[model samples]
Target chain A: MTTTPAADTAVTAAALALGDDALVLSHRLGEWAGHAPVLEEEVALANIALDLLGQARVLLSMAGDEDELAFLREERAFRNLQLVEQPNGDFAHTIARQLYFSVYQHLLHDRLASGDGPFAPLAGKAVKEAAYHRDHAEQWTLRLGDGTDESHARMQAAVDALWRYTGEMFQPVEGIDGVDWPGLESTWRDIVEDVLGRATLTLPEGPRTGAWRAGAGRQGLHTEPFGRMLAEMQHLHRSHPGATW
Target chain B: MVTTTPLEEQLLELAGSVPDPELPVLTLRELGVVRAVRAHGTDSVEVDLTPTYTGCPAVEVMSLDIERVLREHGVREVTVRRVLAPAWSTDDITDEGRRKLREFGIAPPRTGAASGPVRVALGPTRTREGGPADEPEPVRCPHCGSPETELLSRFSSTACKALRRCLACREPFDHFKEL
Candidate 1:
C-alpha cells in the first residue's frame, strides 16, 4: 500500500483545494449568523457552516497546521473555489450558491467515499453530512424558487450570477481519481434543472465553458472580493496570536 | 501505559456516567463514546472517547466535562483522548441509550435496516423479516404511539436527529437520524 511521491503530492494539493473551498464557504455562511431572514434559517446555515468548518479542520490539518493554513495564509495563497468566497449577497443569493456547491460537494464526497482513496475515511464520514447539507439547500431552493414572484426572480438571478463559477468545480484536479467529472457535472446540472423547473425559473443562457468560464481559484487566483474576506477572517486570529481563549 | 487501580476503576464509572452535553438523557457509556479509561500511574487518569459525528462541536465539551467531573472527584490529573481510527457509528449507541433517547422524546435509531439510503416513514411496521420491503417501518411518534408522522427536516437541533412532526399529537419531536 505504498503511494508514489507524485501521487502523494497530488492528493495533498487536491485536499488543499477542497479544504480551502470548505473553509471559505463556512466563513461566508457564518457571516449570516445573526442576519438570516428567519431564525430557523440562521440555525440551519450555522449548522451547515460548522459542518464545513469541521471538514476544513480535518482537510487542512492533513496539509499542515489547520489554524495556520486557515488564518495565516495570504490572499493569493488561498486555493478555495471562487464561488464559496463570493459574498452572501442576499438570502436568495446565498441559497443559490449553496445549491450549486452542495450538489457538487455531495457527489464528490460520494465518489471518494465509495473508493479506497486517501480521503476515503473523511469522505465516508462527511458524505452523510453533505447529504443533509444538499437536502437542506435543495429544500430551500424549492421553497424560494416557488414561493413568490419577487423571491423567484431573486433566486433565478442568483443562479444566473453564480453560473460561471460552476465550471471550475469540474476541472481535472491532479492525483484525484474515482470522480467522473462529466458525469458529476451532468448530474449537477440535472439536479439544478429539476429544482429550477419546479420553481418555474428558466436557466440563464450563458457560457459555462470556453472564453466565458470563470475559475482559477484552484491556482490561487481568486476574484477581487476574496482579499477583503480573507483579511476579515484572519483579523482576530492574527490580532491575538498565541493567546489561548 | 499504566495498570488499572481500584480508585482509577471507580473514576471510570463516574466518567462513563457523565451525560452527553447535547443529549443529556444519555451517558457517555450508554452512547458508547467512552472507549477506555486507563490509569496513567497512581495520580493521573486517561479516558478515551469517540465522537458520534466527526464535526460535532459537542465532542470538545464532552472531553472538558469528563476532565472536570474526574478532577472534581479529587482525581489529581485527567486526560481525555479522542480516538478516530475505527470511527463511530449510530450502532455504537447501546440498547439502553436507544431506549433512553426514545424516553426523552426522541425516536431511537431503527434497527433491521441496511446502512445505505433509507426511506424514512411513519407508515407500517415493516422489517427485514417482513421480506424484501424497500421502505423502512415508520418512526413511531415519541409523544404518542401513532405511526402517523412527517419528516419536517433532515436536521434538528443537532446533526444526529431529524425534525419530525406527529400528526396525532401535533408535536414536533426529534428522531435520531440513522447514520
Candidate 2:
C-alpha cells in the first residue's frame, strides 16, 4: 500500500515498536547460550532467539537501516515494550516472560496476517514461528508449574512479578489498522488463564499495569535493566563502525 | 501466475538445482525455496526465493550458490530477492524430496495438514488423541518405517528439523518439522 508521509511516519513508529520488542528479547534469550540449564534447552532458546532476530531484521529494515536502527540508536530512542527488556531472572522467569510475550505476538501476527496491510506478508510468516515459540513456553510452564513444590512456587512468583508489564501489550499501536484491542486482550487473558489452570496454577491477582507506567516503554521510557542490556548489545558495533568479517 | 519465457524457465531450473547448503541431500527445487525467476534481459535475471524459516542461516548460502550457478551458466547479473507471502511449509517439499530425505536417514515431514506449530501434550506417551481430523499424521522412523516415534526436542540441528527417537528401533533421528 502507498502511504503518505504522515502515514509513513506512523508506520515507522509501529515498526520500531514491534521490531524493538523482538530485538531486545532475542538478545536477552541469547544470553542463555552458555548458561542454560541443559544442552537441549540451550539449543531451543538459541533457536527461538534466532527466529526473533530474523524477524527483527525484517521489521527494522521496514523502518530504516537495520544495522543503524539496532546498533546506533540510543536506549531512549527504542520503542520496545518494557516487558521484553526485563531481566531473565531464572528459568521459570524466562519462561514466564516468553509466555507473556509470545502469546501476544502470535495473536497480533495472526490478526495482522489476515489483513491486507504493509505487515501482512511478514505476519503471515512470523505468526507460525510465534506459534512454536508459544508452544515452547507453554510446555515449559506446564512442566515447571506442576513439577515440584519449589518449582511451582518459583513459577508462580515469576508470573506474578511479570504481570504488571503485560497491560502495555494491548495498547493500540499507531499505523496498525483493523485490530480489536479489547478483543485481543480478552482472548490473551482467556488463553493464559486456561494454560495456567491446566498447569495447576492460578492467574496472578496483581495489577496488570503500574500507575503512570502504562505504555511507558512505547514512549521510549524503559526500565533501568534496559540501559545495561543496550550497552552490552551495542558495544561491539559501536566500537568499530561498519566493521565486518 | 505469470507465464515465463523459455529462457526464464531454463534459468529457474538451473537456480533450483543448487543444493541446499544445510541439507546437501536436497536441492533448492526439492526444498521449494526457489520461487520464481524472471529475466530482465539477455544477461540480467531476477529470481524470487522464499526462506524455509525466518532465521534459516542457510538462505544466504543458498542465495550465493544460486547466483554462482546462474553466473556460471552465462547469466551475467543475478539478483535474488526473499519473498515472505504464502509462507513456505514443509508440505512444499516434493514427494521425491521427502523420499530422498528419508533415504538420507532423516524422517520427512508428514503432509496434508495445514501448517502450524504441532501441539505438545507432555504426557508420558506424548501423543495427541481426539483432536481434529487435520491433526498431523504420525512421524514414522526413517530407519525402521515405524510409526511409533517420540519427539525429543522441538529445535534440533536446525530450525526446520526436530529431534525425535523411534520407539521400535530406539534410534535418534531428525524429523523435518511441519512448518
Candidate 3:
C-alpha cells in the first residue's frame, strides 16, 4: 500500500523529533569531552557521545539527506524535544540528564524494535547501544547519590532541577502522528522507578502538568540554543556541501 | 582419491586465518576473542567472537569480514555470534600477538593494569584534596623500550587506544589501554 503524504510526513516528523533528541544530547555530551571529573570518565562520556552522534547521523540522515535535515532546516523546522536541548548545568546535572534520557531511550528502542516499521532495524541496532548507555548512567547515578555528603547534595540538587524536564520526554507531540505503540511511557516510568530505587534516591513528586515553557523542539521549532548548536555542527558541511575528505 | 579436510581442521584453519579488522596484526585466534568455531554440516561453519572492548564499533565490521573471508575460502554458510560474558581483555592477547603489536608501533597493553585509583582535584569549591593523577607505574615506551613516557592525549584515533609520547624516541604512538 502506498503511504499517503500526510502519513509519510507524520513518520518523517516523528523520526526527526527522535533524531533531534539524539543530536542535541550528543552535542551536550561532547561539551564534556575534556572536562569530566576523571580521565576514565572522560573517555567513557566521549564514547557515549560518539554513540549518540552515530545514532543521530543515521536517524537524521534517514529523515532527509544528512545535509538538508541537519543544516538547511530553520530552528522552528527542527523537531527535537526540549529536554535534550537544555544546557548541561554541571557534572551532576549531566549525569542526571543521562540517567533519565538513557532509560527512556532504552525502553523506547526496545519497544520500537518489535514494531513493523522501516525504522525497526535501526532501532534494533540502537537498543544495544542504549542498553549500555543506560547501564553507564545508572552506575554514575548510584555512585554520585550514595557517595560522600557533598556528592550526595550536588546529585540531589541535580535531580530536583532536571526532574521537571523529565515530564516532557514522555509527553507526545501533536501533528507528529502514526505512533500507535502502546505502554511505552508506562514502561519508561517503571524502568526509571526501578533504577531510582536501586540508586537509593527518592522520586520527586511534582505536578506532571505545568506551563509548557519549552515548545516545538520536536516540530523543528527549537530554542535559540539549538541554532547555536546547529551552526557549530553544520558549519563544515554548509561551507562545502558535497566535500569529502 | 581426493582428500577431504576434517571439519575440526577446517574450522580451526578458517578461524585462525581471519584477522581483526581494527588491529590487522592480531588474528582472532591469537587475541583469544574467537571463543569457538563449529561446523554445522558439510558446508556451514559458525564462528563465535567476544568483543575486546565493551563499545568496540569494529565488532560489526569484523563479523561481516569473518563471513566474507569464510565464504571466499569456500564455506557456503557462515554465522558470526558475538558473546558478551567473559569479556575479552589484554590478558587474552597472546604473547605472539603482543610482539606483533610492538612491531606494528602500537604498544601491547600491560596485563592486569586496566584500572587503578585516580586522584581528582576539584576547584576552590572542591572538597577533594588532590588533582587528577594515576598511581605511579612504569609504562614502557613501545618504540624504544624505555620506561620514560608521558601521556599526550587520553583519546586516540580509536576508542581502545590512548596517545602517549616516548621521551627517548620523541614519537607519539597509540598505547592500547589496559582495558
Best by DockQ: 2
Chain A TM-score of each model, in the order shown?
0.96, 0.98, 0.87
DockQ of candidate 1 compared with the true complex: 0.31
> Per-candidate TM vs. native?
0.84, 0.96, 0.61
State each model's CA lDDT, in order.
0.81, 0.89, 0.70
Which CAPRI level is candidate 1? acceptable
Worst-scoring 10-residue span by lDDT in model 3 chain B: B118-127
Query: For candidate 2 chain A, which ten residues in a row score worst on lDDT?
Result: A205-214
Candidate 1 lDDT by residue in tens digits, A1-245: 78788887888888899899999999999999889887667878887888898888888988889999998999878888888989999888999999889888888888887888778878877776787787778777878889888888898889999887888888877668878888988988888898788878787667664353445888888888999998899999899996577
Kindly indicate the candidate among 1 and 3 with the higher DockQ: 1
> Model 1 segments beyond 4 Å from truth?
A1-5, A209-215, B1-16, B35-48, B65-87, B112-114, B117-136, B151-154
Q: Give the DockQ (2 decimals) of all models.
A: 0.31, 0.58, 0.06
Off by over 4 Å in 2: B115-135
Give lDDT for model 2: 0.89
Considering TM-score, where higher is better, how would the candidates rank from best to worst? 2, 1, 3
State which candidate, 1 or 3, has the greater lDDT.
1
Which candidate model has the greater DockQ, 2 or 3?
2
Task: Tell me the tens digit of each residue's lDDT in model 2 across B1-179.
Answer: 78899999999999999998889999999999989999988999999999988878998999999999999999999999999988888889999999999999998986854355433332232333454565546778899888778888888888777888988899999988777
Steric clash pairs (candidate 1): B121-B138
lDDT of 3: 0.70
By TM-score, how accurate is candidate 2?
0.96
